[model samples]
Target chain A: MFDWLFRYANPARFMGLSGALLPWLWSAALLTLATALYLGFSAPPDYQQGRTVLILFIHVPAAIMATNVYACMVVASLFSLINRHILADVAARTAAPLGAIFTLLALITGSLWGKPMWGTWWVWDGRLTSTLVQFFLYLGYIALWNAIEDETRAARICAVLALVGAVNIPIIKFSVDWWATLHQGESIMSGNLAGPFLVPFLVMMLFYMLLFVCLWLTRIRTLILERRLRSLMGAA
Target chain B: MNFDLSPYGAFIWPAYAVSALLLGGLTLWAMARWRAVKAKLATLEKT
Candidate 1:
């Protein structure tokens, strides 16, 4: 059933396949992002939040992608731990910086939004704090990977760290409910956000996810090429 | 395009700007690394 995925798991095969797919992915991501950004101007303002609701367009998507990208990294780390192949390690390693950027984007955008509405740049609210922790987790994972010289050993240890950090994902998600937090409850799926706000917001979310995939794939391909170059140099 | 994000333009603009800068910078870095490595690998294999 998953043979297609497994078939391309080999670095050579993955290069052949992803090379064919990446142009399309990049184009689609850019086109949709342009559409979403344009539509954003038309997204209706909140009666309570006013045009400040505009912040929600970028903030919510970056926040969601921050957690989602980390989750993807965890899955890649699992594959890295279980399999002998280096492709999984390449994936998990390549994704760390991207995830860190997304997490950073989320935190900064959230801070920008918080100041006007919450009257403060930040608070020790559960969700905000956990998300901050998530950013540090991403940074730590990257630093740990770079600190170690041995690839295989670094892969295994970092995989374990990613697995341990997986516990924080749910905490970030449900922190609003579990603790009285200034971060509002999830409104995207609960039919709470108005239609005008919802459409552009959802499109922006799609744009962010697509952008993440395109960049992630590019980074993975770069790592694979770097590995190939290393082996060629060693052989020479 | 909507410059009328007034009353809250200060906050809204910065949020968008930050996201744009970070995401854009990452995209450029990824593309550059991929291109550089791909060229180097090609040169290596040609030899």
Candidate 2:
């Protein structure tokens, strides 16, 4: 089983597989997102928070996926550093920008939501600070990769940075509990995800995951094609 | 739904507008990057 899995680790095979999966993932993402949007807008406003709670339909999923994607990058970086897998490095590199985008979305939307709820645009609380740090770490990782000319050298440096940044993930996760923050703690996972709200939230989460898969596959395929072109040019 | 939008609507509208702008901007950036990458690949192939 492991051997069969490892066989597709070849960049060429992975590219082919990604191409096959892309259409399906893209369609699924679109459909799920459409449904999520419909449900989000149609749902009755929260009795307490009213219309402002609608922001969570997008904010929560973006925040969750941002953290999850960074964790994925850390794992990929580890594999690249330990086993010297070019594909792992490629995965890490391609995922960073996408993750950063989602993180930025989360932060912006969170701030927007915070303004009406917390009456402030920004705060130096735990969840917000840790997420901000995660964003910077992403920028640093991308900068490291771009600054180094040699691909292998860049991968090594990025792998080190990714590992170091992994420490922040836990901090972000527990920030609401650990420190005084304007951000609310885990409402979805801690049994606070009750009836009507929970269903739409889960649907949105599914939509976001599908979106990530589609984007990840597309980016990785693009990277593989770029590499092939470079090698072909070098040969000529 | 008899509530006052006069006061909070200013904040609400801008918030939604910014969200639209940010998401739209990011989408365009990613699509542009993808196209650039594809074009480079095409040029190499032609050569």
- Assess each prediction's global lDDT (C-alpha) against the native: 0.82, 0.76
Give stretches of model 1 more than 4 Å off. Answer: A168-192
**DockQ for candidate 2:** 0.33
Candidate 2: which stretches are off by over 4 Å? A171-193, B1-28, B39-47
Tens-digit lDDT track for model 2 on B1-47?
Answer: 22333345555456556655775575566667678888988887787
Q: What lDDT score is found at residue A195 in candidate 1?
A: 68
Error of 1 at A223 (Å): 0.3
Q: Cα deviation in Å at residue A30, candidate 2?
A: 0.6
- Tell me the tens digit of each residue's lDDT in model 2 across A53-130: 556767788888878999889988988998788888888998999899888888887787777767787865666777
CAPRI accuracy category, model 2:
acceptable
Tens digit of per-residue lDDT, candidate 1, span A123-160: 66665777888888899999999999999899999999
Query: Any residue pairs clashing in model 2, and if so which?
Result: none
